[model samples]
Target: MLGERVKKLTKLMLTGLTMALCVVAFSPTVKAEAAMLQESEPNDNPAQANQLPLNTWVKGKMDDEYDYDVDWYQFTIPKRGVSQIEMIPDSTNTSGAGWEVSVQDVNRHEMLQISGRTAESYKLGLAPGKYYMKVSGIHQTFVDNTHPYNLRINYSESEEWEIEQYYENKNFSNANNILPNKKYTGNMYSERDVDYYRVKINGKQ
Candidate 1:
């Protein structure tokens, strides 16, 4: 009887553990890890652009049919975070004249761009929104399927120290409420970009 009881207890314990693991596995706390991905065809335009995950490598090929052929990839972040996009071409065209990368907004407005056979850019204040990464040949006649490329992008969920990324407090009326003892961050993506903040104090010495 004791041996049978022990067997039953063991089964119950194993069942409970499995249930707990299932909960954790389906939990929403999971984050994307660095992984390899392949680009799907028909991703030549923003409308048909491939959905890219954060901190992952995606292999793709640019059209050799025309120099204007572009590969567009779309990605999103849960919140404001610093991100960098790196591009590497599998060819001997090491000069910056061969290819280019444009990080653009949902409307296809270029934010930051890098021109090179291979390159990457890093920065903060990348607003929380849908963005696109575009890669294409600058002006090379000798480009085609033989020249594939690898692209990777990733982002953090932290506001920059002393810099504001989705700075909605750009004006006095829409100023951001800040803390007295805490530091903030700001970044101006363009000349027109500005930052504003407001803090209240109480109890004077």
Candidate 2:
């Protein structure tokens, strides 16, 4: 009788230990999978969805050459999902005269020029590609005072990012080359003439 009782106790103890281990090992996996599912889900609001893990972006007034800014005469847009664009003229209201925005392909060829508020932003409805933005302030009456006009671009892909001023000037260029991909070329806009400006290769090739 004693031998039988001892054998029964040992088996019960072994079963209990095994069950405890299984519970601990599987618990972590279940939690991790749930978190991942939440992240993968798509939100109807593009602006809200792009708030996850912050990525590198460009902004601020065109300073010296390579220096970028965070806010102020500044606008924010996502490099990914950008369906809207806003123009903030300096106190001088440079935009009151007129403003133009444009986009270019990788090869620096002019893809499109948008005049008026209707064309401020474009929804391509395609995957991410190498592109740049150009802005021009057109004024009928010449404002002798130099005003700092801010450009704001909003893109929506996975996030809503903005690119203000990417100064591809001297100082930060190698052998007279302003960061091959980040340099943009644009001339002061004119009322009768189409203003030419290029988006610094803000994104990769």
Candidate 3:
């Protein structure tokens, strides 16, 4: 009877040890899976603005943490130039809310604001200095975390060649006349229009 009781006790100990080992092996995997389901949050205010460089594009997202989420970006133009700022939302963003973009000078003065449901862009002649761009959802309704946007900045130093209206040169065959190494400005009234230019190259190297 004593030997039988000892065997039963040993079997119980072994069973408990096996169950503990299984728990230890699978706990980390369970925790890891839980972590993978969580989404990352972006910087919300101007104080955590992301720094951007000229002629570069960045990706940003909106989250549900706040009623209004604003993303800030800063860039510096080394010389007096024309700057083109563009913001395009992802097609997967089915949220009916639109977005707003605002540009500000280094002194915190608002320079320009663009708002609409579609992709938006702004071209302006800015002085050589630092500028900040603020992006937010319109009417505080943008809360889709899965969708992101693309922001780009393009700048070119002010050139001697100036053409205010190049509407007729919408195609390569009807390219606007221009001088080489000169900057020109033209109006892009609509999204369907393209501005084409023909530059005269004087000599070959």
Best TM-score goes to which candidate?
Answer: 1
Please tell me which model should have the higher TM-score, number 1 or number 3: 1
- Which one wins on lDDT? 1
lDDT digits (tens) for residues 68-156 of candidate 1: 66888998866855777788874543333356888887766666777766787746556678888888877763434445778878677
Cα TM-score of candidate 2: 0.33
Those runs of model 3 whose alpha carbons end farther than 4 Å from true positions after fitting are 1-42, 140-146, 160-205
Off by over 4 Å in 1: 1-35, 91-97, 141-145, 161-177
TM-score of each: 0.68, 0.33, 0.53
lDDT of each: 0.71, 0.38, 0.65
Candidate 2 local lDDT, 42-84, one digit each (tens): 2222222222222222221222222221121112333534344
RMSD of 1: 6.6
Ten contiguous residues minimizing lDDT sum, candidate 1:
160-169
Q: RMSD (Cα, Å) of candidate 3?
A: 14.0
TM-score of candidate 1 on Cα atoms, chains taken together? 0.68
